[model samples]
Target: MHIEDLAVPSVNMVRWGAPKQWLFVTPEQENVRAFEEKCRETFPWRKQARRPQRAATHCSQFVRHANVLVTTEALLDWGIDFSETICREGELVVTLPGTYHQVVNMGENLAEAVNVMWGNCGQVQSTYVCCSRDGCGHTGGVSQEDLTPEVASQ
Candidate 1:
């Protein structure tokens, strides 16, 4: 991942690639829309139930055609500063609501991430802009009521 990475609110654990670099934008509600738009420019989040987490990998054709090199410029244009951080192995990066972050693996490596919203994590008006044409998206508030408390990967 070069730049222009779009992600939802979550925590990322570095299982490998100790010296991984990350790009982040301190999410301001007014700026989230623009930030998401910039990310969409590079990787559009579409497809059945697919989130931004899958765009960079699952959408091969889009990835090939998208010019993500302009990510830095896009971030700046949106009044969003892309902050870089390097995490060592076994480090966990927690993202607060309304913040946007991206990870760049130094090389072939493994990493695990989980997306969760704490019930007491305060209210962020946690909004996600979905590009789905299936009508499950909105540009504003996604409250706790919108999420489930458990997961079944099977």
Candidate 2:
């Protein structure tokens, strides 16, 4: 079939709606060791609204539906981590439906950004389960999953 032969419906057509969204800002995008150092950073971390990173380590969270992450400044990376970026006014990262990622504030302003999720119209499902002892507790989050290899092989 031709590329245009495939028929996928648009989210606006259905009354389903978009994914959840929120803005985030942090002081330093700390590594595993400097994790504690970030506590002293001057970003806003509301005690009640604090949601731990949803990955094996402190990485960015993925949105269930489609999302547009607009950063106020440039971003830094961790060794070889990869993400989708489109730079216009600032930098807009159009993340894969559900891909695991992390970010560092290469820019100056703490780290400001807005995320919009497209809920049901999104692609895969992601699961971040925390299985730690100390009876501290375990939790998991479901988002979309990555579809790179599956699409690339074709």
Candidate 3:
């Protein structure tokens, strides 16, 4: 629903709401660790996960709490004659969240980024719109509708 432009190798903020904005940057092990500490200093009770993609080549067939891919080089030149292009990298196309957005690293060098997610303690659940994928469909935002006190701790 929003677009952001950032200079290469710089940190960019993506505001999810209130104090939940994510600061995305290239994966620096130290910075990633420090950022986690800061998030905990504020919300000490939220569960978190920070890990590397299983494959050093292409990403696996799965999803994360959120993603911040750090491409030191260009991405693959794939065509998207379908789907609405919501964001771009200097005219190169990129997919937005809620869509089946996948990427392939074009450079032979390794690329990296750090992803941080909170509220994973049964407080939020992933929800999709029309359909998961294929044909006309786009996923919706994560939902907190089922987080009644009784269900939250389950």
Q: Against the true structure, what is each candidate's TM-score? A: 0.53, 0.26, 0.20
After the best TM-score superposition of candidate 3, give how far the Cα of residue 145 lies from its true spot, in angstroms. Answer: 34
Give candidate 1's error at residue 73 in angstroms: 3.7
- Number of backbone-clashing residue pairs for each candidate, in the order shown: 1, 6, 0
lDDT by residue (21-140, candidate 2, tens digit) is: 322322223432232222223222422132442221232221211122433332232222223322233334433333233343333332234333344423322332222221112323
Model 3 poorest ten-residue lDDT run = 1-10
Candidate 1 deviant stretches above 4 angstroms: 1-8, 33-70, 122-154
**Candidate 1 residue pairs that clash:** 18-89
Q: Candidate 3 versus the native: TM-score?
A: 0.20
For every candidate structure, what is the RMSD over all alpha carbons to the true structure, in angstroms? 8.2, 14.0, 18.2
lDDT of 2 at 130: 23
| TM-score winner, 1 or 3 | 1
**Location of the lowest summed lDDT over 10 successive residues in candidate 1:** 56-65
Ranking by TM-score: 1, 2, 3
Model 2 TM-score, all chains together: 0.26
Better structure of 1 and 2 per lDDT? 1
Per-residue lDDT, model 2, residue 55, is: 29
